[model samples]
Target chain A: MTEERRPFVSARTVAERAGVSRSAVSRTFTDGASVSEETRRKVLEAAGELGYHVNHLARGLRERSNIVCLVVADMTTPIRARLIDVLTRKLQAAGKVTMVINTGTDEQSVASAMRQTLNYRADATVFLSGTPSAKLIETSLANGQQVVLINRDDPLTGCHNLGVDNEMAGREAFFLLRRAGCTRLALVTSTAHTASLIERERVFVAVAEAAGLPVAVMAAGPTTYASGYESARRLFGRSDGPDGVFCVTDLLALGFMDAARHEFGLTLPDQLCLVGFDDIEEGAWESYKLTTFAQPFAEMGDHVVDLLAAPVPVIPGRRIFQPVPIWRKSIRASAL
Target chain B: MTEERRPFVSARTVAERAGVSRSAVSRTFTDGASVSEETRRKVLEAAGELGYHVNHLARGLRERSNIVCLVVADMTTPIRARLIDVLTRKLQAAGKVTMVINTGTDEQSVASAMRQTLNYRADATVFLSGTPSAKLIETSLANGQQVVLINRDDPLTGCHNLGVDNEMAGREAFFLLRRAGCTRLALVTSTAHTASLIERERVFVAVAEAAGLPVAVMAAGPTTYASGYESARRLFGRSDGPDGVFCVTDLLALGFMDAARHEFGLTLPDQLCLVGFDDIEEGAWESYKLTTFAQPFAEMGDHVVDLLAAPVPVIPGRRIFQPVPIWRKSIRASAL
Candidate 1:
């Protein structure tokens, strides 16, 4: 457009117009600095005449920007996607701007993302993944940055941790499968390095071992649909495969179900029963009808934002939630 | 935890330490400004000694932050979730930070979101929804901001638009259904206010009316699974329902498929043929196996970010994509 860059109104001009000292104009703009009511009125009038607006970047040089940084490993996941959607809405409503960083599941990427956020001098930071560097967190905490960790548990004094109760969820899955009269139970999951998955698998296997149930553990490369399908093939290929399988995630369960029914020619609820975590929209589809646990994503989002928006809690409490189980056609009716 | 805020290194300190004029220090930081190598070296040494980082907020007051604002109506939608994920990765790789805002599908909320972006002085703004305000667009354009619109068609001179060929998609749906030897046809969709949906429905209805086909237009409340199921019940409850049904989206198609099979006791691709848009992950489930059109989200995201990261295109252009139809079990084999 070839528009010329207009010169900004200086405090000197406001001072001259207001018939006050330049320090008066400066004090008027500075928050909590003393300025008489008469001088403030004169500065305000002169500033209005010149159409002068405070340079927030210049102001931010002296203070913190009302910018919150949310670092997530991935946003494409259904749970994360829904959580981010709610978070952005709530934060925006609370008059806070949020910058989202999608750091891949690698230590180097996570470290780089943390460095970038630190450079931004964000007022607060929220780690949506579990892999944030301890050194980075310590640095941010040292700088008096309020850090909130979601889906991660850490005993650090400076950060607040929020997560789902994976252990309880694991126990529920074991009992649900046993009640369905499935003597053989299995757990299907990926080797993805998420703390939530690790906890769920740990507890589920421990419970099964305690009860002396015949259980199989199938692990795959990644937590994707293809991985789920591959895990299903490896688990079900054996003659002594489990009849009831609990998938660590809904997406994996979907993949397992599709592979079992289409490629393996297995009918669900008769030959096998499957359960999944995360009652995502697809779980309720007529085709899958997956019995699953619904992550309290909406509540978690609300709580996280509330903690972030408010002053640091007195004790930096750890908030944990138990996922709710949703029943569908994937499980036998007798179990319900 | 009670660490005091460290004092920031000011340009005056650098000037004094380097034994140079304050203007010389400012010119060194200013891009493309004249500064001798000796003076630059001195300023760098002095800055290092002082552990000084350029106050980006202060610098932003003069120029713009490398911040790109992404405005989406809802990130919970599958397509948007995938798009945002790719955009975040690509933008981060390009050294640009992204702030996401979820403005609900309403004029007031969209306008408010736009205002917030402008206040942040976003170097570039990308609207992932079609409902952005025209006035806001003009103001941002006048301010020389590179604005990109995805899934929205506009004749504005300065903004680049990326979207799918909704009209062509609609026609393809009609022909595919007709080829299945289904005389009865119907289009199922929500009353949501997306330009893409509007265009798709317009063409579908026009072609059906032109061909003198008996078509039922079933409209639901929101573009949700429950809405899709409700629409299916309303459509199928009638005695003379269409044998071939086209859902505007994959989620809706899933809902209809479930309701048709379970509630109505109808089999897919036998009693009724179904075609959906957007090849979402759930569509491939063993239960549905929905035949649908897949939007090239990854390609579109790359193009959008490329446009945003690079200098504004010499001539702002419109990029339209043709969705590829994915064949599955939902539609009659004869249709292929």
Candidate 2:
């Protein structure tokens, strides 16, 4: 059918044209509204002719938009920022509104942000930080709000947890390194007592010990480049530097690899073998080619928006995530 | 003066305590409200006692919250993500609400997102893209909104641009490399169109050509690691790999370095010397330790927010930007 184009118009004008009240017109555009589908088509067609671009913020005030609060912990990691970017695009398309709260590591600041997040009456809260405070989680649960954790393990019991299985990830690294004929190995993990790292560490150590291989553990202190630098000093100072190093996170691995190669001229799988978790975009770079546990961020992102859209009861619980390992040239086939 | 610690209270309670209407309490919290100082202080005290967090998004709905639309091109880089994170925190603290609009490489997406960005009745628009369209920039100016481009080039015309000088960065890298004594060199940069990369490429090529030294240009398409991977392959394919290679971005450098060392088994300085721009955290990783340009993301973040928070003018068009360089150990030392 041929359709005629009309001048751009706002929703107010569309409501006027449809002869329906503005609220009725709004209800037509709203998802999950009781408005008959027939009316929705009419409002949409009118909006099409009028060139109306819905003001989402206005919709929230009209109680027509469901707000999703995105709580991001740190921004230094490209993965964190990329996740936020991806979620923003998906949420915008799904017709849901987003409120971003960039919380600090400070407890008081986090607590304050949580309070502000509540005032926004977000339909759901997606916590991107590992180790989201127990106090904050309790408050969120008490308010009967749904909480979803990304790249975070759930210690809050009931919150929906979505992340790669760290235990399996650790084992994958250990087995891969062992097969690569590495005589000595080092585990590079940081000192943030979150489920994500803790589980990975526990599994890595357990598997390495069970195999009866001489393994050393290096606590990177915090997941930062400085920590990796320090770890390198310690590893290099050792009687015999590690032939293989499995970093718990990609950031630390990149750090370890850079310091080892650039500072000390160590080569991977020949002089040393390096592996990391989180197949961040940088890992595939011509320089790093970091062998890592590749979690499907896009898929996880899709799952997150869907999980949070519908409120779920938080039952204090545990969910161990499992992600496949992405193999690169960090280890040589001959060594394996 | 003793302050009473009251339990968390809603706005309604603050209204009751202040002996004013709910709307009055709202107006008091909102910026530029016509409330008396005494009344404003009274409302704030009550709200504080009750542990009330302002629902800025809600206030935004009522056209009370000064909406600041942040148009981010993308946040895939650690430095970019860090800057956006800092901007979000500062803006939130200042009571200026933030609404993000992502404008990636898609020109249509950027233009459409810009229109949606304007529908929010934003008091100002923060263009955070590397290449914000002239049309979008023009539209924002036409709408009489303050525009600030953080970590992006100053627009050719209209809007304030804040970014580091990547050209001087190139000059610095050359000097640093020359001091280290490598005659033949390779300069790898991301897309030649981005203002930052363009500056670096121009200065790098011009300076080397002027100095009568052989210089090869490696154009990495984007700022991601994958792009660097392809560039590194082509660079190494040369009859004799250059003694030193300079990547326009730390991320690209990391990738190029990874492919050279990990995949190709190239030894540092002997086979390939790597230096990159933007001393992102990953550049310091154990594997990369990229000697490169560095910008203070947190400082730039604070700087941009402060600019955005200042009184916006009814008149449009402003230019503001600053740059700094960070040096590391990715390049080779003077050949003895």
Candidate 3:
């Protein structure tokens, strides 16, 4: 099956010239390995004279090529909005053409996109969302593909995971509300089954309960402003309505705020305290100045690219992060 | 040079079975050309069995492959954010790689990036920019490379041009201000020196002057929020200064609003009217429902891909445009 395709200066040719084995040729190019400087120099001189370049493709899984597949849930979501652009450019600068796979919010579709990336022979893959099944992940790894999860949890124990600390971000938001003097705090919840949203909710409830204070949480179907708008009625219908509400995302917070202000005619910072996570650009606009926490997107993006291109998997374990709180006009402190 | 490039479809290849001449085969396939239904069916059946497909590339160079380069100026800019992701997906969807060229800001860097794209064997290239060029455009038709200014203005005639209509957009802002009853108006400008800003300036001036109203326009250097923050002194410096200010971009508008409200302690929408362009996500935030206009980015992206995929040269003096006005809460209506 190995057809004599395009004949070029390859690893075998390099191995012969360097008076070394094919694996030795690969080891020389690898980031770190014990190769004496004298021997390295000899190999370099022979390669330079012969106009031979190391075939990175033959190296162990990672060094083959810089090609990385960018798998995103949606093209226009505010969360992954800027990260995708920065990551793509950064990868391209490293001589990698990002095989962008747009998986429109379906896990199955994400898996199919992953299959296409594998078939196209990508060196590494970055999943923006949707946890790849362990079996497929193992298959891809078996075929020598590196996988990195961006702003998400790593389903595989040893995979590179890069994202913000959602639990601490949630706790910080709760305190911001508590500092605002609203004690009857409520968590604006969603049953969308996303890891990020789930982590935030867990933290918000844990922080409240740990302080020996009663905390309330309500789950609404899916997550969107439209959903939050509907949740306002259901949450308020309860006997013990909330004086403060914390949404998992800024969009949902805006929906909740709109429901309280425009719908219920409840003047903001007077009747209820509201806050959100993921300080999207829109959160600071005149109408929303939504006090929210932000996961450092630009830094996270650069880290993702670097980790995927790193010499070795430097950071181990599932990365847990805390988003920095961006104090804007939305919360109106003293409501906790 | 004119090797028969694998004939699009051969009549003889089909005729050997049809028992007819090449002329008979041509008549059968040509539209409105005389051919009996029986013969037509026979010819089509032969074509199907042979697995023949029509080639759309050669008609008027329609079949000739024309490589397109898609260039972007800073991905961090909100206007260009998520744009590359969409463009790449769309371009690849059309079976084109769109040799992406990333250029630095300032005219010289952008030109170098354009040249790099040209070096990649691009027949036509598109530049996605906010600033228009100051240097006279260079044209080399012999090379078959056409310069397409995407989302920017064209200085030279016969150059491909496409962008948002800033004039009508300006008028929309004017009407919003007029309705808000702001008699005194000022425009916060940037020194980005782009064609987009120039056109917006032109439209705003035309609308304001034609309305026979008192309006003051101030131009400032630097395009970021911090830049506008530094220029806040000028806004309050002038006696009988503007009661309403329209900024060239949402970022500038945010800075101006911050300066007017937080620093100067002026109530917004009452003491000053603010309008910005791009209708960026930030514009919809709680603090600055910036009444502004937006370009249909996705539609523009789709069109750019479509135009580049088709190899046929466009008719001279032809252009396509679509501009929209997005109304938010920043500018008050009839409150002067």
Best by lDDT: 1
Q: After superposition, how far is residue A11 of candidate 2 from its true place, in Å?
A: 6.8
Q: Which scores better on DockQ, 1 or 3?
A: 1
lDDT per residue (tens digit) for residues B1-336 in model 1: 443544445789899999999888889987899999999999989976764545556666766577888999768888788888889888888878898988876888887777667666677888887466666676666555678888877566668888899988999999989899888888988887577888888898889889888678887878878878988899889988779988999888989888998898998899999999988877876677899999998888888777877653435788999899899998888997
Docking class of 2: acceptable
DockQ of 2: 0.28
Q: By DockQ thresholds, what CAPRI class is model 1?
A: acceptable
Tell me which of candidates 2 and 3 scores higher on lDDT: 2
lDDT (tens digit, per residue) of candidate 1 on A142-253: 5556788887765666677888889998999898888888888889888875778888888998998899986788888777777888888988788877789989999899
**Tens digit of per-residue lDDT, candidate 2, span B192-241:** 46766778778987888788777888775877777787787887887877
Name the weakest run of 10 consecutive residues (lDDT summed) in model 1 chain A: A1-10
Model 1: residue A59 alpha-carbon error in angstroms = 3.8
Q: What is the interface RMSD of each candidate, in Å?
A: 3.4, 7.1, 12.5
Could you arrange the candidates by lDDT from highest to lowest? 1, 2, 3
Q: Point to the candidate with the largest DockQ.
A: 1
Q: Predictions ranked by TM-score, top down?
A: 1, 2, 3
Q: DockQ ranking from best to worst?
A: 1, 2, 3
Q: Which candidate's TM-score is highest?
A: 1
Instruction: List residue ranges in candidate 1 displaced over 4 A.
Output: A1-56, A154-157, A312-317, B1-55, B154-157, B312-314
